[model samples]
Target: MSDEGHWFYCLKHMRVEYGPGCPNKDRMGPYDTEDRAKHALEHARERNEAWDAEDADQGS
Candidate 1:
């Protein structure tokens, strides 16, 4: 469960990186693949939609 060799999407620069390029708070990470990191925004939106649907299903 370590962060070594992981990829990250830097929100500040809007790019993907594989090392300690930006602050953790300003990036989304630990993605196993660079492709996933590259589509971070899309992945986030997909997760958000799934959560929103679940919330609607729960009536909350």
Candidate 2:
């Protein structure tokens, strides 16, 4: 790919086509290179977990 920071979206659900009514669709990065994309994906996972935990605690 010519673009170094090509966006790769997260697909949390098995079959949810992202958008309204779909599950998680929050973007976490514009990571550069394939290796960075992997890292960014990991970051996204961690970020989501932390965010969810914080929200859960807040809701309690």
Candidate 3:
């Protein structure tokens, strides 16, 4: 698959960027779509919540 012109959500800058503007460690991903990249933070929050709930359930 061609990786040219990928989209990423920069955690450090809190913005969407095309191609490699920031380091991978500080970015969300080379998302398939720009819209998906834009929702990176929301997805992260959902995953975090799910993980937290799982942890609580395991603890109990």
Winning candidate number (lDDT): 1
Query: Lowest summed-lDDT stretch of 10 residues in model 3?
Result: 1-10
Candidate 2 regions with alpha-carbon error over 4 angstroms: 1-29, 32-34
Instruction: Give every collision pair in model 3.
Output: none
C-alpha-based local distance difference test score of model 2: 0.48
- RMSD in angstroms between candidate 1 and the native structure over all alpha carbons: 1.9
Please report, as a residue range, the 10-residue window in candidate 1 with the lowest summed lDDT: 1-10
lDDT of 3 by residue, 1-60 (tens): 334678899999999888868778898888978999999999999999999999999999
**Which pairs clash inside model 1?**
none
- The local distance difference test score of model 1 is 0.90
**Which has the better lDDT: candidate 2, or candidate 3?**
3
lDDT score for candidate 3 against the true structure: 0.88
Task: Sort by lDDT, best first.
Answer: 1, 3, 2
Best by TM-score: 1
CA shift of 53, model 2, Å? 0.6
Clashes of 1: 0
Q: Provide TM-scores for the models.
A: 0.86, 0.43, 0.84
Tens-place lDDT digits, model 2, residues 6-59:
533344432212223322344433444445544665677898999999999999
lDDT of 1 at 21: 73
